[model samples]
Target chain A: MAKRTPLYEAHVAAGAKIVDFAGWDMPINYGSQIEEHHKVRKDCGMFDVSHMRAVDVTGKDAQPFLRKLFANDVGKLTIPGKALYSCMLKEDGGVIDDLIAYYFAPERYRVVVNAGTADKDLAWMRQQAASFDVTIADRPELAMIAIQGPNAREHFWTAFPAGRARTVLLQPFQAVEWDGWLVARTGYTGEDGFEITLPAAQAMAVWNKLKDAGVAPIGLGARDTLRLEAGMNLYGLDMDESQNPLESGLGWTIDLKDPKRDFIGRQALAALQPARQFVGLVLLDRGVLRSHQKVFAPQGEGETTSGSFSPTSNKSIALARLPVGVELGDTVEVEIRDKRLQAKVVKPTFARNGKAMI
Target chain B: MSIPAKLKYTATHEWAAKNAAGTITVGITDHAQEALGDIVFLELPEAGRQVKAGQECAVVESVKAASDIYAPIAGEIVEANTPAVDAPESVNKDAYGTWLFKIKPSNPSEYDGLLDAAAYEKVAAEH
Candidate 1:
């Protein structure tokens, strides 16, 4: 049986179409996914992200433990509630998972990881922390709700008025914790929003309040499209255990600033050179681009990692790992079934902040 | 759920109706549109293409995923629904009204082999 989140009842009440995703029974959409995508891009939309796991690493050795565990430097998080997006890597330089780590102090840091990789990630974290004086606590008791859009923050403030006072001035990539609520001004949709992690028992009430404040319930179907339009990578779709961050358009997330820092996968990453460039494709033809579609380019053959019809751009778009020689403005052919459809290469992002960048 | 009494349905979720022109017109069922969410694009079969029964000849893409529209029976494509192809969401709006393509059936009697409203409802329900 698939695991259900704390907001499963709320989702069912809201008439969501439920689908089993990565062992969790999650809402795919309340209705039309395109409408939900537009709602997040244009106005306020809330998502039940409770399936993601929150692991609290505490103790004197917490900072050092995370520094070696993630590809990004945890040392940069000097101020309280500063969040850093990083990729956790295996020894082979392949990505284990991408996560957001929020630092409160040297002794306490919270890392939120994807649902599908939770067990494997926890095992890896524990193995890495065996020598360090750290305590890894997987908080299954917590629930996450992400409210996003151009007008998301204001609506979130409207939903929980007292939350405004604490989180109002929080900058992008920052978080604020009070009582059981940890409101982070970070999201995967590339929009201005907050992802609130709170006590799981109180999730239904929070969802109700947010719904009452005109924050429409969005779902995974919209979430996928929204993130895709934002040029954000989906772990299983865009990159997996077999792929590295450099070829997955996540090179920026890997921190190499600290020369003294010897992290996992650093050797493999430093010694090896990447032959592929991660880029975006705008479908010039009248068909949708799906994953594993064979891409025919002048430089060499490439493959689409993630593909979708962008509601923001009103066109089919995709993220592809192509040969290094493929440049922007170059038109490539993608074979969808029998026909080779033309697509133009561009910067990996398609839209963000209620604007279509394509 | 709107399984029109006049039309026939395939287990794959496509609906077919004999038009006034005597050619069989095909479109996806309403249940299909609901399952697919929002229709984004339609890849219709060419006007002159030949197809066999249950042959996957076209595509109906939604925001979430792509689904194949199979030919109900063997026939030569007489006309592709240009307007519905141009605006695929029309099928979502009215699946029975927005036909995908028209096929001149190789055996017109093959249309009788298709499931009727009562039978299609069972198939739709099983999904």
Candidate 2:
């Protein structure tokens, strides 16, 4: 039997179609995934993302430990409640996981990792902390709820009236704690929203309250499409331990400006020359783009990492790893079954803030 | 869940409706559409194509995965639904109302071999 989240009962009550996702029995959709996808883009929708783990690091050496663990510079997070998106890499510069780290203080930080990589991430962090003076605490007792859309913040304000004053003041990539809840103005959907982490015991109650406040319950199916449309990358689908950030469209997250800071994977990354380019594609045909499809450009053949139909754009889009010679506005042929269809190369972000960026 | 008693069904979850003109209209069952989630793209065989029973003649791509639509009986494709090809979501909205393709079956009696409403209900329930 797959593990169940605290809101499993609530999902069943809502008549959701349940599926096993990363060892957890999660809701794929209540009904009509397309409608659910549009609900998140146009209005407010709530997703029970409790399966993702939150690891807390504390003690005197927390800052230094995190600095060595992640590719991005955590020292830039000078303000409390500020969040940074970074890639935790192995010694060879291969991406172990992409995560969001929220700095609370010099000795306190919380990092949220993907659900499937939680156990591996915790084990890696623990092994790396063997020589450090930090304690890595896995907080499975906490559950996360991502309320996203154009009106997501308004719905959050309506649902949690007490949190409005403080949450409203939070800028993008910032978080605030109030009444045992951590509300972060960060989301994967490329929309203005909040990802709230609270005690797992309160998950069901909060979910019900949000439902009563007219927040539609979304499922993982829409979540994937939403993140894809936002030009965000999925961990395993987009990149893995064999892939480095430089070739996986995550080069921006790597901080190599300071030579004195010796972070893990720094040496391998510094010695590497990126040969592949990660880009977005807009299908010129009336078919859907799927992952693992062959992409042929003038330079060479590449593969699509993630692909889906974009409801916001009313067209199919995908994130592909292509040859470095492939530039923007160039046309590439994607092998969909026996046919090679034309697609236009463009920026990864197809939509943002409830608007189409393409 | 909405199994029309008048139509015949295949174990693969396709429904076939015989019209007075002898052409059989075919589409996926409501249960099949529900399982497939939101329909995104559909690939139907062109008209004038010959299809055999149990042969995969069409493809329905959902947000989650792609599923094959098999031929219920051997027939010549007379007409393919253009609206369903243009807007695949119509199949999710009303699977029965949005027929995928119409065929002139070579063996019209093959429809009698398909499952009835009661048999199809059992098959759908097992899924």
Candidate 3:
């Protein structure tokens, strides 16, 4: 049997189209996915993201252990509740998982990982934490809900006002605690909002309360499209264990500043050269670029890692890995069916904060 | 779910209408279009293209994935749906109204063997 979130009944009552996602019974959409997408872009929407695993790391060696654990240095997080996005890599410089690490203190931190990769991520962390005094705890008892959009914060504040005391001034990538709950000003969508992690028993109540407060219940379908438009990388598609972070439009997450930090895969990442790079593609013609489709750049052959129609832009776009020489504003041909469609290469980002950048 | 009583259906979810001239108009059922939400692109066979029964004749792409549109019976294409190509979502909005392509069937007796509306609805509800 597939696992169910605390808000599963709520989703059913909302007339959601349920589907199996990563061993969990989740809602793909409540009704029209495009309408939900537009709702988030123009106003407010909420998503049940409880399937993602939140692991707490505590002990005197937490900071030092994490420095040695990930490719990107966590040392940059000086303030409490500051979150950093990083990729955990293997010794060969291949990505293990991309995650967000929030620093509460030198000895205390919280990391959120993908649901499908949670088991492997925890096992890997446990194996590495053996040498340190750090404790890795996965909090499955906690449920997370992400309310995202332009007016999301206002609606969420109306649902639970206690968070306002600690989070009223919280900036992006910051978090505050309220009644043992972690309300973080972070989201996967390219919009302003919060991701609240609270006790599982209270998950449904809070979800309904938020809905009563006028927040739309979005699902996995809109979530995928929103993230794709935001140029955010999906774990299974954009980067896998065999793919390098540098070639997956995630080089910014990699810290090459410390040559002596001696993190896992640091040496390999330093020595490894990026032959192909990831860029955004705008369909100049009338077609959608799909994953695994061959992209014939002027320099060399490439492939699209993630592609979809952007509801905000009203056009089909994609993130394709092309030869290093292929820069922005260049033209590339994507083979769709039997026809080669022309597409323009732009920087691999379109929307952020509910505003279109392109 | 809207399988028109006047139209005949196949086990693969395709609906066909027999014209007085013996040609058959074919499109996917409403249930099929609803299952594949928010159509984005469509690739149909060219006019006069010959295809066999149950053969893959066209492709339909939604926001999620791509699926093949199979021919219900053996026939040669006399006309194709050009409007659905540009506005593919019309298929999801009204499946029966937007006919995909017209096929000039080699044998008109094939229509008799097709499933009726009630039978097709039962098949769709089973899943």
Candidate 4:
């Protein structure tokens, strides 16, 4: 049987197309995926992202334990409520998952991981934290809602007037606790937004309140397109245990500068020279770019990590991992079906925060 | 839902209408277009391409995914829909009105194998 989130019934009531995603019954769309995509880009939209796992790590040893576990240095999060985006890597420098760690104190941190990789991430965290006196618990009792787009924050504040605390005034990548809720001014969409995590039993009320406030309820369909347009990496398609973070456009998140911090993947990462670099590709011609498509450069071969039609660009674009020698402005060909279509390599980010950044 | 009683449909969802010129004007069913969602690009067969029954002849790409448009009967393509290709979203707006292509079947009796509007509706409903 497929797992169901707290908002499964709500999605069904909204006439959403339900599909089994990562062992969970989730909404693909309410009616039209295109319309949903436009709504988020043009106005305020909300998503029931409750299926994503939120694991809290608490103990006196949490700081040192996370610094040793993650490829990125968690020591940088000195201020409470500040968040750090990092990739959890295997001992051999393979990417296990990309996640956001929110620091509440020296001994307390909360990390949100992808739903599909939740089980594996939890097990790995537990195994590593066993000797550090840190407690890792998956908060299934909590539900997460991501309200995104330019008007997302304003609409969320309007939904619960009393719920908006001084923490709601927090800057981006910051989390604040208020009224039994953890409202993080962070989101996956390349838009101004907030991801609110609250008790599951109170989720329906919050969703309804937001709906009454005229926030458009979006689904997985628009979420994928939005993230792609923003140039954010989707965990499974962009990188996996089979690939290293350095090759998947996540090298910036890895902190090799901290010589004192010996993370799990430190030695492997230091020993291996980066053979390939991830670059963004904007299809100059017709045809949608898709994952697993072979990218051909004059100098070397490459493969598309995440590719799709950008709703903002109205053209196909992708993130391709290519030979480290390739630079921006170089041309390449992507094999789409029987034809090899021409593409141009651009800088990493193509769009962000509901606007084109390229 | 817009299946005309006078038209016949293939299991693959292409609808065929017997044109006055002894050729059949074909388009995908409304159900098929809706399933595909917001058509972006369409590749129709050339006017002279020979097609076999159940053969993949055309390609329709939507924002979500791509699908193949199959030939309903053994026929020679007489006319291709150039207007529909230029404005593919018209298929989503009015699928029955925007014909894909015209085919001259070698045997008219092959039309007997096609499903009528009522039968096609039942097939679509099953999905």
The best candidate in terms of TM-score = 1
Query: lDDT tens string, model 2, B74-127?
Result: 999999998778889999989999999998999999988989999999999999
Instruction: Give per-residue CA lDDT, model 2, range A172-276, as digits (tens).
Output: 999998778899999989888999999999999999888888999999999998999888999998999999999889999999888888899999998998889
lDDT at B63, model 3: 81
- Residue A228 lDDT in candidate 2: 92
- Give each model's whole-structure lDDT: 0.93, 0.93, 0.90, 0.87
Residue pairs that clash (backbone atoms under 3 angstroms), model 2: none
Candidate 1, residues A1-358, lDDT tens digits: the string is 9999999998899899999998999999998898999999999799999999999999999999999999999999999999999999999999999999999999999999999999999999999999999999999999999999999999998988988889999999999999989999999898999999999999999999999999999999999989998999999988988999999999999889999999999999998789998999999999898888999998899999999999999999999999998999999999998789999999988999998999
* DockQ, computed on Cα atoms, for candidate 2: 0.82
Q: In candidate 4, which residue ranges exceed 4 Å CA deviation?
A: none
- Candidate whose lDDT is highest: 1
Docking model 2 quality class: high
What's the candidate order when arranged by decreasing lDDT? 1, 2, 3, 4
In model 4, state the lDDT of residue A9: 91
Global CA lDDT computed for model 1: 0.93
* Clash list (residue pairs), candidate 1: none
Using all chains and alpha carbons, the TM-scores for the candidates as numbered come to: 0.99, 0.97, 0.97, 0.96
Using lDDT as the yardstick, the better of models 1 and 2 is 1
lDDT per residue for candidate 4 within A30-77, as digits (tens), equals 877778887887888999999999999999999999999998888998
